[model samples]
Target: MNLKKSYIAAIMVAALLLGGVGAYFGVQLAQSQDSTAQQGGNGGTFADLSEEEQQELIGSSQGNEKLAKVNKAFNLIKDSYLEDVEDSKLIEGAIQGMMDSLEDPYSVYMDQETVEEFNHSIESSFEGIGAEVSMVEGKVTVIAPIKDSPAEEAGLKPNDQILKVDGESVEGLDLYDAVSKIRGEQGSKVTLEINRPGVSDPLNIELTRDDIPLETVYSDTKEVNGKTAGIIEITSFSEGTAKRFDEELAKLEDKGIDGLVIDVRGNPGGLFTAVEDILKNFIPKDTPYVQIEDRNGEKSRYFSEIDEKKGYPINVLIDEGSASASEILAGAMKEAGDAELVGTTSFGKGTVQQAIPMGDGSTIKMTLFKWLTPEGNWIHEKGIDPTIEVKQPDYFYTNPLQVEEPLQLNQNNDQVKNAQIMLNGLGYEPGNKDGLYDQKTANAVKSFQSDNNLDSDGKIDEQTANKLQADIVEKIREGNNDKQKEKALEVLFQ
Candidate 1:
């Protein structure tokens, strides 16, 4: 039989099986008819097929035995089942089963409700706790909380393993189902039981869901040793992220910053278009940013068209939370020699998925291609390791109780000793690394705070301690055992 004839014959078999069920199935057949019309006279209508012709088509497609088995099963369920089943439910289940058989996690069937939620997510406004989560190691793990979001306010941290949602265990649950349990109408309360890395006991955090307004680009200027550097943090590449990034970079340029740091530390990737647009700012025109390779070995390259490159030393910070479009941007920048990547290995997710709308209001997100860097490296399942691997400070995993108490002038303990050591590491000159919060130590703290833009209170509060530890880690990462802000500044000055 001709290929077109065989294809139409297959659809006819499906329509005939579902036609007697409901009006929805009838509508589906009508849509198929419309498609057949568009295809022209490859084969005549179902009415034109004689009984022998129909049997022949069905036999060619599935053989008589397999088709008989399917028909028998359908009739058995419909006639002998204890409960009445809806035709829509059966059709949906069959579709889901087909998708499940592929065994690809990224490819799935989205019902109408799921489609709406997916659209809302891309639009960047949703009623939720405002955290990007994913299934990691068989648990729902928080990638990051959006800046100024309810999740951030509730103290949700990166790599937090969510054990329960609203008093119900989320173990073995789908990531989307867990997310649905956590998300609700605005002003609704949702409780999360979190198991952090160092904490022995699970911490239960209560948060009020709100309408999250996402801001993808956050930029500020920092003066290091009298040299200015622009620090831009991209949370996610939402709809307006590219424009926001350009505007922020322009402001930094107007300030005449000597260096730039692009921080995508906990950014779960968003739209590819946003990442492409941002690449145009720093990559020279005609430079290939990324390549997409399809199943048939056809490849397409996405290139940059910016007239000029930014004349500044660039550093990119990424962690395990950086994925998808974030990896694309990072890979492009590193391949183009436009920036040096810092931090740890990034989250590997190089596959591309396209959401295709069905005739109904549903959608099917199918993995269509795999992305590669400009240098032709496929970073899927294997993340991109940074040039400089800077591990997070040990203090990051410490219990909040250990660091929450403010160390004052009269306090002398292990916490104070730790702070003094960090301060001395950063060249704060706190006299001694002894466990003593003396007047000299207090004076050193005040001086350090004055230079670092913190309040000159001469007390080691939570914020002060956190900053001190971060500065110490940064100093070590810069290859300086005892200095603040040396590596990037040296590169910029050179």
Candidate 2:
């Protein structure tokens, strides 16, 4: 498939990201949705229905008396409205109105262009900041930043409200329109004004858009207690994820590792069957890994064929950023596999959605089912809590300093206070982070300046502040100081 690499996703998705924005996952979980609109085996690519197909849809739509009133209103608006309006626009608007009435964020109407982008082959690369974002409560909110992407590097966090893109307010813009503004050519810079939770002021995050790779599984080895422990980090589930996971885990097993740790932090999720395949490696056939409930309230359970679990203990890492299919994996590991979960909590998204093509190039991705964990727990809005909760270091959540002016001795303000916090976190140890720059704070600043090869002046300037933030971000990314990761690895053997 010579599909163009999509630039944006719901977060280029898990649609494989609505920028590559947030969780627009593909559904192979329920094959019934794909049973419709079939065209030559590309998984639900049906369009321009035959006579029989059109009749099937119309027969289902017939005998709805309220639709007559809706049709009457549509005609009245078309014939008697004060201004000229295109019929296509009116129809699309009507459909959008219906979607809004449903009040489901994941259930969205995709136009032809968006539909094409949304269905972009999972095997392709992605471009953008690489965070899954959605319109939440009238504001475009970050669902989760893709691992190793520019969005993650720039510190974009889940639930972060994006107020503007490059100074333009996004108050009235829809998600796609806002995503268009956020997406850019690789190497181009985009500035996002973010209104994050618990922050007094909006943050200005500048990122250089880049290509997000298609690879979803990352493997490594951690030596814990003089024993080699395998660590598999699942950034997202995609078409090739399960195979990669299997190959990697087999290699780890070949090495005779004592235990295993699967990390799914900040994973917005991808294809359903992809996660299902991965679960088959851990979840036994005796119990169902996940259960799906349709609109009819009928339940269907899915189980793995494996009769026994792994030889060693296992632990899964999760946080508020871990969502959708990620939740499914974590839930299975916690319940079915009897593995401990480390980290704060999982992102509570237990619904199943499918993008059914409208036969007119457009598509409607609707939430069709509610997914429950193996124990039949519906964790919709309430996320799954970790068995052993752990948080990252304080510096990981430190506020980004927007120091317009230099901070010198005796200056009392937030800028000074923020710099002190950063310096303390970086091991400089400034006396009292009280938003006041004392002589000791100045010394700490001078020490940081000297270490970074800047002028050893006892003042926090623009260059100095930027360097501090960069270094802090680097430290946060290092995982050397990450407490959650430390706990996750330690719990593997304990």
Candidate 3:
């Protein structure tokens, strides 16, 4: 019985050993199948890839490789983060990073809430404080307040540095952020602390918000060299500006005006089409006026249609404050040789933006096109150079006009004297060469204009000097109405 028990035990041990070996081989086969399936699904294993593929796996691809690195870092944070993170905030940050990459002062990413507020401002007439704003020298400056607005009523002037809005510092805020903060519901009271040049201390003013009544066109008649010149000051290119300009032009013509001085000073542009229509009134033929280049390397040309009133001599005046549509118009007129541009270099603003509507009530204002001059010059970074440059006087041109006779009028600091010298050469008696543009100089200018038969506004400019030289029949003066047609013809040809 003992021997039989021992043999049975040995057989049982062999069966157990065989079973253990089979189980081990089965596990090895299963693992092999799993690894092969993983390789097939992912296309290849990490060990099978080349050096380039290895770098790509870690996101080292060229052409936006920086963005790829950022994306990889974010993914790592998401996958291996110790604490849970909000995906929405991360997404928002990514959007902001995208905008920051563009490095544009005007281009920005608006959060959903801010975008909603912006939409409300455009669609409805809700307002907090009314002021046109811009970023000048990296500071938030008030361009101009709307006429009859709370800002104007509160004695807010143009070029006022808005230091604070409702006690919030405007230091770090961009143009759009500052604008958004200043704009709010109508009837809401807001306070502004400003820092002006002439003011001794910071000026604090409190105002209540109201509707911003649109005043697109401002016109007046200034008598120059005994002839009435229509002076139209346009602050913006709104929907009503073109129609208003047309009406103003008709009124000036009816009043027997000799020349037109369109002042587009301190004008920030609005709509592109409105300025195009305005340009058509002066340009006679269907000519290319401006070129638009997009992000995708696509381009488009905007043309000026022919006008019936091609007889008018239009002189456009621009300054450092003129931007966007203002620059576009100036460039177009100068290229067409239809008008003379006189003033300082214009503000460089070449990009065209479009407010793309979201499914929600909000919108995203994205710069889509870059504006180009007719001469194919990009006005971005580099501003428009004036054909004729004229600098303003340090002091006002008052009726009595007392010149601040500097102790010594050196050539280095006597621009007025230089102007007088130029005028004297142009056959205008500028009294004594005292290096001053005073009342005597103004009177002398009037006398010169009277003798030359031009407008008697006492303002010596390129147009007036050119007219005086062209007539050559100096001292044989004629009425403005009689000389208007001739001057217009001269300007048209020039």
Candidate 4:
């Protein structure tokens, strides 16, 4: 992001004023978190109001008629309960119920402990599986895993419902509680029983939690067909991201790259200002890069100060994992900057949320605005479209082959089908993926085993399945066949 003091301040003022929530875009929060624009956060509100204003608001709130029924219930529960209940607990439960009534997963209430954990995860990093999650339909659903984090490394996909953490059911638990269970000491093993969509049985995925790092930008250059393309992968938008992006971009430009590919495939998003700063680099001054709409439908259009677009082609890589600020950037680039987006549809998240602190340590994160693209299109629930839709190889989507019993010839089952998919992805074509363990599939399994230096048996045993999964994961990590990226380069030079 381009963080010129004057420009960043201007944008911050717009966000705070439109947010209409007390300066929850508080200076400390903005400075500390760079005003993260992710889907969730600790509290940032109640930081700017003066003592007099706070007293006035509190005094007025006490006499609010809208809360008459609520107060009556609160008093009844407090006075005539069979068993004693903590006043604080009842009050917090009320707050959480109100948030639940909104029916929006992004809005939530976090207590001090949760707030501190959330803040820690954003500020530096934390020891956990490293995935952004939400309470969707009463289930703790993964929004997306952080790039290169344990959650991603463990094959946790977007929308995977975490049914159990460490063999204990997380059903009926709030998003915070479920996530707390998922997090543990660094290097400790945590097993997640995941209810993946379309799978008949839940899979137990064991992951070793590690310290998730804070760095977001990764840069490299790819030489393809005589043209060098600069590739910048933005894992998330956070403090100093714009500066880092600028520095890396300059280095790429210095090397005389012919084209550029901006990869935000698994980026879950960060601060609004962080993305806004990055937009200024590519989007021309003539068009509004993003438009923020408030509760009353008041719109604030934000534009860059740049005179023109870059000379070389710009291609953005997006997939199901790109969200929020990532979507904001993708929308702006495709519509206003004319950058070609090469990948599948993105994760749709269009609302902007700001956290408001309660007098106590807890805070309420409320969705305050709906952001639209430069073309006045709201991609909430409906993702931004790619100019050239390119899908990765099937291996990228293949799940781990679970082999409880040896999958040998003549066996036909879902497990066998899954194994066939993996074998096919490994280039040992299993002839068909219809769940039939035919002679050809057995041959493929034997070939794969031999290649991995295992016994040349034509059966997919536990060891063979593990080896197959490990090799496929390693190939994916190496990106030996990233079809989407190849398409981006193809479009860049076309």
Best by lDDT: 2
Candidate 2 — which residues are off by over 4 angstroms? 1-23, 32-55, 58-63, 120-123, 411-414
Compared with the true structure, the alpha-carbon lDDT of candidate 3 equals 0.55
Q: Kindly report which residue pairs in candidate 1 clash with one another.
A: none
347 Cα displacement, candidate 3 (Å): 2.1
- CA displacement after TM-score superposition, residue 121 of candidate 4 (Å): 3.1
lDDT of 2 by residue, 109-220 (tens): 7678865664562347766788888777788999887766788777788889999999999997767778878877789999999998877789898999998777777788
Most accurate candidate by TM-score: 2
**Which pairs of residues have clashing backbones in candidate 3?**
224-455, 224-456, 224-457, 225-454, 225-455, 225-456, 225-457, 226-455, 226-456, 227-455
- What candidate 3 gets wrong by more than 4 Å, as runs, is 1-87, 123-129, 135-163, 184-210, 223-226, 254-256, 295-299, 307-309, 358-362, 391-494
Cα error of candidate 1 at position 381, Å = 2.7
The 10-residue segment with the lowest total lDDT in model 4 = 2-11
Scored by CA lDDT, what does every candidate get? 0.64, 0.75, 0.55, 0.74
Per-residue accuracy of model 1 over 119-178 as CA lDDT, tens digit each: 455343567787777666667777666555667656677779999988999996655567
Q: What 10-residue stretch in candidate 3 is worst by lDDT?
A: 1-10
Q: How many residue pairs clash per model?
A: 0, 33, 10, 8
Give candidate 4's TM-score.
Answer: 0.89
C-alpha-based local distance difference test score of model 2? 0.75
Error of 3 at 62 (Å): 19
TM-score to native of every candidate shown:
0.67, 0.90, 0.57, 0.89
